[model samples]
Target: MNIKLKTIFTLLLVAVLGTTFCFGQRSNIYIADKPFVQEYSIKYNFTNERVTLNSVVSDRNGYIQVLSSHGLLRPKAGQFLFPGELVNDVQYRPTSDKGITDADIYKNQIIYIDDKAVLSNAWAGNLYSRHDLPNAKLFSAGQDFTFLIADEMELNLLKDSETLWEGSLNNEIQDIKYDSENDHFFILSAGEIYSFSPKNNKLELVLQNDKLTCIEVAGKKVLAGTSDGFFEFDAKSKKHISQIEKNLPWPEITTIKSVDGETWFGSTQGAFKLEKNDKFSYYASKRWLPSDNVIDISKGPENSVLILTDAGLAKICRKEMTLFDKAMFFEKQVRERHIRNGFNATVSGMTEGDVTSGSMETSDNDGLWTSMYLAGEVFRYVVTKSEDALQNIRESLDAMERLYTINEIPGFPSRSFERRGYKYHDKKWRRTEDPEWDWKSTTSSDEAIGHIFAFSAIAELVDDAQLKSKAILLIDTLMATTIKNDHYLVDWNGEPTTWGRWNPEYVNARPIMVGDRKINSSNYIGMLQTAYHFTGKEKYKKTAFGLMEKHGYLENLMRPMSEIGRAPETADDWSRMLSESWNHSDDEMYYCGYWGLYRYAFNDELKAKYKEAIVDHWEAERPEKEGLWNIMTAIVGDNDYDLEEAIWYLQEYPLDLVNWTVKNSHRKDIELIPENFREQTIKEVLPPDELRISRHNANRFDLDGGSDGRSEYSAGDIWLLPYWIGRYLGVIGEPVQK
Candidate 1:
């Protein structure tokens, strides 16, 4: 065959194999269609300062009732009733009765006790049973109208408004719970746990501990809470079932309850639920509660959990959702509040974390963030062919195009742009030739690589001829200018920006251990390969090869990840600083550049090497469970790149994007480790909701951070990009039917 015909035939063969690989085995490759818990919270603050909440219960209708020192109070909903919706109008309205001290839900009936008598709200408000109880503190109801009431030092058993048996204890009573399966009531005090059998009229000590504070009985186990932690005992054997569990979010356990066969604990610091695999889903801070000091917990309306705190009540609701469902919800979130002049932006300066009180703000890395969002939309358009996705791509592409034209330099893209006087206070802001506009300077390599990644995706995947041409032109403009200026992005001041220099002199100066050495080589070569692939330009191809063979760029890019660490003591100051810790931003830059590096390799041999490098880096990053990085690694057709963890990341991320203050450094459940070069603080990473709101550039292992709800991050770059990209790669399936 002629050389021309041979080349065409090879291209056709590659196309056929690519199609087979992408769609043929898609059934086995996609994310499983399983439901995940999506949690959100609704909080109601105290109406008055005098009401002291003692206990909480919910009836069959899911109406929440709180027993306080003043009276029975019902928390009325406000105009807005959805989860994560904030309204100040929800108030605890008092009932006609007063001086109620204890309450319980007995067979869907709300029963109450006061200083004088026991009352049942089950019989048309006329079921008052008189009793000689004084200073009633707590009560447990049993079958056939049997009640076990306790005071500070005494207990009274009443049946049919008559005294059945009375007993005394050595210490102050704390709580009481009835075990229906065992036909007995378990009593908790400061020193001991006792079981009272009404049938035999006997009270016997079951367990003895001075620190016991609360008690709960579930089927065959009895759980007792204490100041240090909690202990479990077998109900049938009356012996210890487990040791004291000190590994908790907070150990000062104040209350414990079993709701829907799942255990929930309330501590002085917050509340947490015991999930499968011995993990606790921590609910603390203002994001999930009104205050961290939890008083009680109960099942609430619509399969929610109600947490009573010193300041107010919090209702945590969970909805069943798949990854695709979450993606669509985040898509709406971005379009509503995060779009600023077609650039994905954050809402900053929010007053006390109120979403309605914030305004969109420009950022230094707007170009990078917008490029990520644009690439996500292009992937969405490719996967689903949604018209809305195409429109989003068009709008954001316009914003990206303006980044080049807004500045005076021919191929330099601005960091961001704003009105002339609005951003003039910053030293990086410069007046454009246009009178009404100003453009940000000092653009970093992060923005440069992000632009190339988005442009390459558009040039290869988008079907629009005009859009594809524009994307290729931008790539040529950027790469040509870099080559013309000795591989440096020249600013209007005729100096190279600090981070945009990838010339051999600067890149090769860093020690091999420093991440910047590897990342810069990888990014620069990827850009050259992408340019040559799209534009068919020999200059880009030649420049890329010359750097690889002569300057050892290929060796630098192919260095194993395990060998990259802190610089030697004899290294330069800049190299030492760059290697002092793992630079998470470098991770972001590397993955963003991976799209071009792996997809547009110069030849099959280079493509195989790129896949090895990408997979090696992913192996080191497995501890983080970062969805974006894991999903991006799937582009190399590896089936074992922690796909389950990727899905877990998407599912576990909180629906509320508000930057509420979150702290996990004080948690007792997590296993802390010695400080290392990777900066991993614990043996395992906390879920996304338990950590602060952050973008892909932030370290996931950072224990505590936030602005106390002063800003809301955009979901466009944080969530939607990874999700849509996963969908486009056939690693995540469509939304499953309910």
Candidate 2:
């Protein structure tokens, strides 16, 4: 349950200067920097062989670096500088028998920096790091592929793009399945909840409290869910019998859902419906909502139970309400049942030659045919005559056109932007780098631009005239190269930049513990509002109305409230309403500047100044109980499902959530949902989440503001700021009397 905090990017651990200049420069010049860790003691011999030496490691802040490599040396006093401590002339590639021969890894040594001290290149198993040096591949993949094994993306297991037995929750896990006789699965973390070994993931902490957040398994009974209420333990006397109480017009809780006893909980102060005399009642945003800020609800597929919130997926049904187009036809029967089992859902790479799995791979295999690029464009647009929905849109589009490979190149060219330190994801984005070294810095900016806006939203939702003219010639070849470089983009598509060169120092990123730059170009005018609804292009709606009027959005007019395509809304306010000046990491830049001024900023006193910057950012940071019920009391489906505002901000805003291990960006299409609104929508795929705080305590809070992780704001900042205060400014997809 990780959502809250909207800040971060403070030099993010700093280090990446050297703007440009080179030579023997001593591995590049006398280094007194870059050795956070490079140890290897095990013996007296040569940690294999391939020598080089230079030494120094000071850090009172003078910050310097040179270090070079080949591998194996230790002469700084005990200084064993072997191979005649090479200065003797460069030209060597020794030990080609695959190096390291156990003197306990031949005392494995390989660190670098030369012009004067701060060097060693001993050698053992993998420090191939040396593209002519500079943070020599930053800590040169040392300690055998970097290792920090902590930082709040913890409580885990890898591999999720497609199963190790249906695994899928990296942050929405709420288990408890005891299945028939004795099979187990009961999880929950951070404060504590474990029960594992469901066939060997192993763990057994039964239950510890601090207001547990989720856990389920109904039959043998074990349903937890809490902020203040819900429990049911019974896995063979690990006893807690049944606790239920705490429920009202607002007591908290978040999510529960049980089936037989009919329970359903969802409570950050709203949603409830118990029955069986466990009696709970209470559910509004007005007779079953699209917002009250709920996070996840499950119970779907027939009697329906999918809800999600903060304002997106909804499908209640009991009293009536099931449309986003039948939850995009229950996300096209769960992406045609995961493309009939051949599920790819790729995000990174691994298809090999001519590439595929959408190209680029050193082997992190990010395979996605997105159930066939989203049921082959929802079978050209619902009207499905079913042949299992045209056999899952012809095998998820023959696996997204052979996966990935139609012209690709880059072993380097800022190959993932100077390869940086590491965060280079491996959960899949088709891994290749960032096993988690940390991240130094460089650039590439918007290289793939979320697979070119999900391949231009699958060629503009099926009207694929040559894949929408090859996604408008690849969005004008990435606005003529990564949005025309404003030092890696911040302006060039008509002012207000920050979308193209989005740098969170990519590696294998866990990002978003508290990072902000607010999701690249905060809804980069929804890429000129999807190229002004595909080619209606008034220069893509006047360069997305000049990036929400020179990029500052809801500062005065151009969006905040509503007036649909504008009118005389407020004399165009401009900076007058200073409800504490404003910032939720720039509220996805005023929710994409009021959805690019309600789908094209026509002006209604600037969408009531973007609707009074959402009730003046809750009357300047929530003016009392409306203090947004202490900063948002409900509606949370993802940003890690906010465990009731993460245990009341780790007991009142403790902060800390910087876990960047990014490489390739793994997000194998979970459940997208949107085929003209799938029969009216109600999809639920939950089963991969596991980050219950502890990627080493996920940065140990204190992230008071410095994040840009999740790379600051991109779940499209939960739809350009709750589609203007949640669905076209309330009424859940508009209509209370319009």
> Against the true structure, whose TM-score is highest?
1
Worst ten-residue run, lDDT, model 1?
A: 79-88
What lDDT tens digits, residue by residue, belong to model 2 across residues 1-738? 122121111111011111111111121111121112111111111122343222212112211111224332221211111111112212233431222211111122333322211233343424332122111111111122221111122322212111122232233233333333454445565456765443565556777777787665666677777776667778655688977544333445666656435666666544555556543444433123334556555443334344444432334433222223323333443342222223332112222100112221221111211321332333224233335533444454443333322112111111121132334543222222444322111212232333334434334333324433444444444443433432133221233232234322321021221112223433444454544443343665565465455553212232322221211233223212212122233332333223333333345554444344444333322211111122221221112122223222222211111111211111121233453201211132111011111111021211112211211111111111122122211112321120
TM-score of 1: 0.93
Clashes of 2: 162
Candidate 1 lDDT tens digits, 373-442: 9999988888888899999988999999999999988999989988877664666888888899888999
**Model 1 stretches astray by more than 4 angstroms:** 1-28, 47-50, 76-94
Provide the lowest-lDDT 10-residue window in model 2: 6-15
Please give the lDDT score for candidate 2: 0.32
In candidate 1, residue 492 scores what lDDT? 79
- C-alpha lDDT of all candidate models, in order: 0.84, 0.32
Best by lDDT: 1
* lDDT for position 84 in model 2: 13
